[model samples]
Target: MASKYRRGFDITRDSLRVFTREPSLILLPVLSLLAVGSAFAVLTAIVFQQGLVESLVTNDLYQYGALFCAIAISSSVATFFNAAVVHCAAQLFDGNPTSVRDGLAAAWRARRQIAVWAVVAATLGTVLYILDEKFGVVGSLTRAVFNLAWALLTFFIVPVIVLDERRSLRRQLRRSGSLFRDTWGESVSATLGVSFVFLLVALPGVALGAVGFFVLDGILATGALVSGGVIIVAAIVGSQTASAIVRTALYRYATTGEGVGPFENRDPDTVFPES
Candidate 1:
């Protein structure tokens, strides 16, 4: 895979360059986070309308309903924002101008498909949640393996929803799975790159955390720790933006047979070598 396409770190570097070009891309993830928070707050109100702690402990329907809705909303919000990010990144890579508004509009256009996928995602999540909560170690292991496979299978879904336009959920899943199967090296490797990037950017926060406890004392240590937490959050946001960009780029390249962005004037994967 490394021999066939750009490696993860290289993809991360290029993705960061793309992020700098469209700095506002960072806002999508932030907004998604906030939206998910608000949604869960509303859901909490509904679930606790009877009795929060008591119902959670004794009311099976209320508890499961709350869990399902929470997972669905979270999945839907994440996919929505990821779609917007992909829209913006794809347009930019295609040498076109794109703004947050335009990206949002594109995602809105695909709301139907997103909603359907949300149901599917919610069911899977609820099942996994039940398994993990009830079966202990064996259930945890099963959940982990299923989660990984699901993630890999649907790796290109956000881009597919945004870029492909107006396909049924079944078709979209098929399309995404096929594309991922073909270019997994390019797609999954980008995650490794983003993870590497996160570790690099998060180091300052790690250092601050260490110093806060080990070197500083009392309130100053607390402040250092707080600041470190903020820095780590920022690093996460930045890495998420890069991940979105690389995801868009890899999907575009695999589908269109082009380079990642205008920054790279050649295809990310050049021609296949002689057989």
Candidate 2:
């Protein structure tokens, strides 16, 4: 267990190293956020114009439908940018110069595959959301478990979609699952370390927000709130970018028995022992 934690921390550190080497990688997540925000804004406008918002608020079925549509669209937009990030990460791993434009172009080339995967992911997410909303404690627990499982299973979907676009969506998902199962230990470790890092990153924002709520007033309080929001957003974007880099490295190591950049010293067999 200690070894697993240590390994995860190492992976997380290396991921950060990769990001620092190419600070522009952060742009991918920022772009993703903007794209998703725009999509949500458009969807919200349409929903309100059509009076679907009222139905969504009053009717459970309508709410679910609206939520599903939102999830589908947001997931597609996120996946598109995520694919780009993975492409950039791969390039970084290969010691090649890459920019946000390069990543976006790569993702654009795989837009159709991303759309298919997004639909599948959104359907599963909606089902889980319904389970959590409609059922009691049991449903909530089931949804939580299933959500984690879904994340684990599809961990490599972005890398696969970006690197192996010829594969069918189902096959891509299967490949992702296979790769994850083989490197579950490293995956869990990397996730644990990343979670810890995010928590630390979020703490300052939380503290500022709490101080503003309890102590500050007037412009000072508003400034605190704004600063806190910025910190939180930066943390989220940095964490996401680091995670994509780590996952891309892991996928490359698992598939090719080779590592790149900070991962160069990591032995594939050690990370994912032959089983």
TM-score of each: 0.83, 0.89
Instruction: Report the lDDT of model 1 for residue 61.
Output: 71
- Candidate 1 C-alpha lDDT tens digits along 1-275: 55434444566677777757778777887888779889988877865685677877787776777788888899899889888988888887777888889889998999988999999999998899889989999999999999999998888888888898648888888888998888876566557757876887799998998899899999999999998887887787777777787777778777876676522654544322222
Off by over 4 Å in 2: 1-10, 268-275
Specify the highest-TM-score model's number: 2
Q: Whose lDDT is greatest here? A: 2
User: What TM-score should be assigned to candidate 2?
Assistant: 0.89
Evaluated against the true structure, the overall lDDT of model 2 is 0.82
Candidate 1 achieves a global lDDT of 0.79
Q: Please identify model 1 stretches exceeding 4 Å from their true place.
A: 1-7, 44-50, 136-138, 203-218, 262-275
Candidate 1 has its poorest 10 consecutive residues by lDDT at 266-275
lDDT of 2 by residue, 7-48 (tens): 656766787788676787788899888888888898889888
